[model samples]
Target: MMLIEETTVADDALPVEAFKAHLRLGSGFGQDTVQEPVLRSFLRAAMSAIEARTGKVLMQRSFSLSLTFWRDAEAQPLPVAPVTEVTRVALVARDGVQTDVAEATYWLERDSQHPKVRAARACLPQVPTAGAVLIAFDAGYSAAWDGLPSDLQQAVLMLAAHFYEYRDDTGLSAGCMPFGVSSMIERYKILRLGMGAGQ
Candidate 1:
């Protein structure tokens, strides 16, 4: 089973109230089985832990964790693939930036099919990227019209258009999906933030 945990901000960190409006935006997509309230509670606790450890709120971020399980029955080997579970979290900053985080864990069982094992292994690396992209897109678009340079703004628009085109031509509509645009947008926002801070 997939489990999600929420975190609370640290005493020295940004106020939780600051991010409340943006926090709920991405939760709809990351969690599948858990109730919204339960997920929120989990997130609150998780964020608190993170803030305590890191000394900053995980503003505009999303993450996921995955677990795999398998069981054996009988003297004779039963052929069954392991079950994989994934958990994802998205965080948005008060300023509208967002980040995605995800994790996957694998468990091996006796008498498991080789193909199933391989497929599960393959999906491991992809989980984090998928979560990150979703978070970045949301954060990027939400702040796209803000005080960005003309060139960078144009690039963002182009990326947006391309994402739509990709969705139309290929069954892969990155633009239409919540996570699709997030990764690129997140990067852009980071660059802008860094530049502004430097100046």
Candidate 2:
């Protein structure tokens, strides 16, 4: 199975001013807006790290998940959280024929932590032999940074600040993450126990 992010959050949608305020940086010092790019990069890095750790998408974006078959015919669990909508579901056959699943056949189970695609009836439509199923959906708390949870927002700020403070350090470990950020997002991580089928 493969999951691809089809769209990303826009730069203007990020809370740059809020981040600057959190870092105690002045908005305009003289006629120059110095350090804006650096701050944005750190924020992006922090957001990426937090999302990787938590299996959560901080901003609403489009994604496409491809699979050879369903883990469960009744319901197919998605990898990301807070799925806002399922835009499309298509089945591709070995013969190169593609069929779009009817909208009435499936419905989105928008669980906060574990969103899923559930068949409206008892079972999902039959997938063709040697074919792949593609599920396209939008997932995340919101399209803008302001829509994020308070704790998550704070976590981003904290992590970004840490990155800023340690920018000149070249000895940090590859997998190092701040304790505070980890603590803030501990409850958001998706814990899986030896399971393979469902994400």
- Candidate 2 versus truth, CA RMSD in Å, comes to 2.1
How would you encode candidate 1's per-residue C-alpha lDDT over 1-199 as one tens digit per residue?
A: 2322233223323222223332333445665334434334434444333233322223322222233222211111112111122233243344445544343332222221211222234332232322221211101111212333343333334433343235347665332323433443343331214543311
- Report the error of model 1 at residue 111, Å: 53
Q: Give the 10-residue window scoring lowest on summed lDDT in candidate 1.
A: 133-142
In model 1, the runs with Cα more than 4 Å from the true position are 1-144, 171-199
The residue pairs found clashing in candidate 2 are: none
lDDT score for candidate 2 against the true structure = 0.87
TM-score list, all predictions: 0.18, 0.90
